[model samples]
Target: MSGDGVFSSGVLSCLAALQRLMDGNPTVAQHVGLHRAKITAGIVSVEAGFDRGYLKKSRPAHLPILAKIEAARRSSVSSSISSTSSDVKRLKGKLRLLEDELATVLTQRDKVLTQNIQLWERVRELESAHRNSNAPELTTLT
Candidate 1:
């Protein structure tokens, strides 16, 4: 698909060349418009010549497997994207629940601390009262 000169890729160039060859537009190919003669000549040259290796007619056999491989790669990418998004949603939900529990625990801890302070103050008052009641009266000297 690159415009990197006419014959950059062999068959790739031939495909673009084919369009021009068939159009018969003078602007496209000047005078060498899609002649049945030229196409037949090219086909004959390819067939009669002994240059039979990669560019032969047998390569069409690979198209089906190629299509399947492309489909599978697309499917895997889409599934991975979905799974990653789901994991993020799950983590967000867990984070919210944990934050709620932490707040409740903090509130309960503050209440317990306040209760302990009040109990300590009551204990100090009770102990002082007991000492005062047990103390001997300051009687006048006889």
Candidate 2:
């Protein structure tokens, strides 16, 4: 095979190896260091049994593999962002529910306090009236 043909075959093999890693193939994952590190060009090259030097940016034949790696990285990042956004939304909903419950409890406490104050005032009035009714009558001696 010519140099271009060999590079093309190597590129195709690397792409296949990347796909296997993405698919969670255990053997491929271990071999490519996917289980311990992120999917990088060097890892993919190792998985495809290709030399890492061929993956340099100066090589036109290697550009496609690099592009594929970048695309996979972006895809994982966007998915992670979306999942984090969903978690934030869920937590916000829980916080709103807790705040509402607290408001309800505070309202009930205020109502009970007002009722207690009113009962205390009524008891004081009754005590004053009882004291006045029990007062001894004054006798005037001429």
Candidate 3:
């Protein structure tokens, strides 16, 4: 059966999906089913022709439609994987840049804090010197 002009199971499964779609249409379901039967009959007729030597060929035709579909699916999956990898790399680079920016801002904050502390200490020293210079002077009793 595999070597004959019969469709693979996968092709039949696809046809079943189409049948499900047709079943949902209440008005045209019967007509669609009839149409599908007619199409199946046509395919069988063609297969019979090929079998009876009505159609001569050097080699039998191999309709690997399902295999082709699977290959396309695999190609799409690989493409999406590569796209996701690039997106991750881009996000990591942005994160690194943000971290560097944060470090620079923190360094600037520490420098400003140090300068403020030094300025406050100088003010205290000046006040202490002023108070010491304003003390009462000792006078000579002659």
**What shift in Å separates residue 54 of candidate 1 from its native position after superposition?**
15
Cα lDDT, model 1, residue 100: 100
* Top-scoring candidate (TM-score): 2
Q: Which digits, one per residue and each the tens of the lDDT, describe model 2 over residues 18-131?
A: 887777663443564354227788877877777665476777877887888888888888888898999999999999999999999999999999999999999999878877
**Pairs of residues clashing in candidate 3:** none
How many clashes in each candidate? 0, 0, 0
A best-first ranking of the candidates according to their TM-score comes to 2, 1, 3
RMSD (Cα, Å) of model 1: 19.5
**Candidate number that wins on TM-score, 1 or 3:** 1
List the candidates' TM-scores in order: 0.49, 0.60, 0.45
lDDT of each: 0.52, 0.78, 0.50
TM-score of model 2 relative to the true fold?
Answer: 0.60
Assess the local accuracy of residue 38 in candidate 2 as a C-alpha lDDT between 0 and 100: 74
After superposing candidate 2 on the true structure, give the runs of residues whose Cα lies further than 4 Å from its correct spot: 1-4, 26-37, 51-54, 102-142
For model 1, where is the 10-residue window of minimal lDDT? 43-52
Q: Which candidate, 1 or 3, has the higher lDDT?
A: 1
lDDT for model 1, on a 0 to 1 scale? Answer: 0.52
